[model samples]
Target: MDRQPRQSPDFLEALSARSQDIFRRLVERYLETGDPVGSRALSKMLDMQLSPASVRNVMADLEELGLIAAPHTSAGRAPTQEGLRFFVDAMLEVGTMDETERDQIARTVSGGARGGRVEDLLNEASALLSGLSHGAGMVIAAKSDMMLKHVEFVRLDPERAMAILVGQDGQVENRIIDLPPGLTASALTQASNFLARHIVGKTLKEARQSIRRQSERQRAELDEIAQRLVESGLASMIEAETSTPTLIVRGRANLIDDAMASDDLARVRQLFDEIETQKGLLELLDDAETAQGVRIFIGSENKLFSLSGSSVVLSPYKDANDKVIGILGVIGPTRLNYARIVPVVDYTAHVVSRLISKKGEL
Candidate 1:
């Protein structure tokens, strides 16, 4: 879906208390059952005395304002994508999770992290939110900005070599790189030695820049074949790192369970198929990371999930210094319970931040 302008506050302000209450009830019921709601049903649900005809008239005004729409000619009305955004922005009432829910999350994250890596803790967060929300859960595995301790090239095959990067914290990552044609064992050794000599102690990005500058100055002194190998190893690894930050996804089956119709199931399947390659969704999470708190992207508001008509609720986790490092959230149909999930995402980030602070101080 193409981006539409954000909903104006004027629309909400113009609505009467009755109109707002009726709209609120409609959304609540739709969220509960994933079905369109008729005016007769809404009429009975309203606390005030109003006939079904009166309720339908109010719904007509809402539809005209682009907040609601009838999905079928005969069926009742459902919130439009715009209506969901409007509700989320203006009408949603968020509540703190009770002690039981909080304990569940705490147990899941804390139990999973007992003497485990921070990555494992965050991965547990993904599974926790997916299980709670019944949606696809995800966490953006922040790239290690820790300074590099060592970098080496190991030949795995005649055609390819692996670039292994070890960080100061002892975290290691390996990227497979294509070998330059006719490259020799001696050239590989020279390249590895040059990288360890110059690129060690720099972040991956800094190491990349360092290679370019040092290579230019030492071109005449450096072996030509070794230079090619060094460039290839750094370039390949950096490209791979940027294109695919480790996105930990869990509980995709919940999406199928959430599907309400054949078309809904098909869209969920499309989402399942494309989600593996959705490198673009990172940009949306990046926006959330830079923001102050929890962020919500309704259907079509973010282009990557527009096709599936899904919503995302994201919060960035921080480290000891409270710097936002990575994002955690759930993706499901636009009708997801935003009020319930928003606080969960927010508190989960807090939990993760505390976990990191403890480990960092240790």
Candidate 2:
């Protein structure tokens, strides 16, 4: 469906206490087992004090109300999408991350160093989250929108030099190129001088493109040696494709486990397919930029996640300037323990924001 049908709270207000209890149990069981729950099973386990016949009748009533689904010819029932929504909004008990978990997450996200780079913080955060969540963890690096601080070139030979990038926010990246074939150290130095004269204050794409046009028009105006270095250096820079945001994902293998039954293996395979498409993954997180605290997109609530039967819990991390630099979160089955994982995801995002802010501090 392109959009989820809007559900009114009135349906919840109309449920009796016993019906609500039964609905909660069925949803919980489905989440834990990924199977339809039968009325006899509920009464046998929970001491619900209701006969199987009465429970079955109640299940029928719930099915009629659109809170549960009964697969054809099955005595058991599963929660419909509306049923999961009701459980999340009214029945689920939200929990908080304990102090110990928070402390560890804090250390890992901040890199435990007073002045570590933003890249370090994000890398560590991704690892820590994946290990803890036992699901795929993800982070998008801070965007490059800062003023240029400094630029330097390290000459390797007559033909090759390495461009060392330094951002105003303390991020660093390196671009290296082969020497055009036989230029002199003097020619390389001359090319560096040319770049310094034009490149110190612009973004990498801006600098590379501008340098290419300059070199193209005036190749004959400069010595052949300087011309070769400039041509090679700018060519190497263009090949870098450095403008796209960096995506870090870890622990994808954890998605398959004994918890997933043999018949459900197809779903696991589908999930891996989704992972290979980063554009879809980015779209899934786009709402994070506008969310306050933790945002949960349940199965099929989002198109990108529909086929995977997965849910994403994400929070946006901001830079020192209060602009959102990136997002941090986990992706797992819809059966995830939302009550517990929600706090973990929310708090980790907060820790990441603080670390990013510290790294970006002027």
Residues 40-136, model 2: lDDT tens digits: 8987765559998988888888999998998667779988776777777677777766789889888776653455556667777777778887777
Per-candidate RMSD vs. true structure?
4.2, 5.7
Q: Count the backbone clashes (under 3 Å) in each candidate.
A: 0, 2
Question: Against the true structure, what is each candidate's TM-score?
Answer: 0.85, 0.74
User: Candidate 1 regions off by >4 Å?
Assistant: 1-9, 146-151, 157-159, 166-170, 190-202, 205-224, 260-263
lDDT of each: 0.80, 0.71
TM-score of 1: 0.85
What residue pairs clash in candidate 2, if any at all?
159-179, 160-179
Worst 10 residues of 1 by lDDT: 1-10
Shift in Å, residue 116, candidate 2: 1.9
Tens digit of lDDT per residue, candidate 1, span 1-362?
Answer: 01123454566677999999999999999988888999999999999999999999999999998999998774699999888888887788887788998888888898757854666788899999898888888888666565778988899988898888887656678888999888888888888887888766787778878667763667655588788777777777777776765678898888887785525788887676667776466685577565777878887777777777789888887888877778888998888898888898888888887887777731
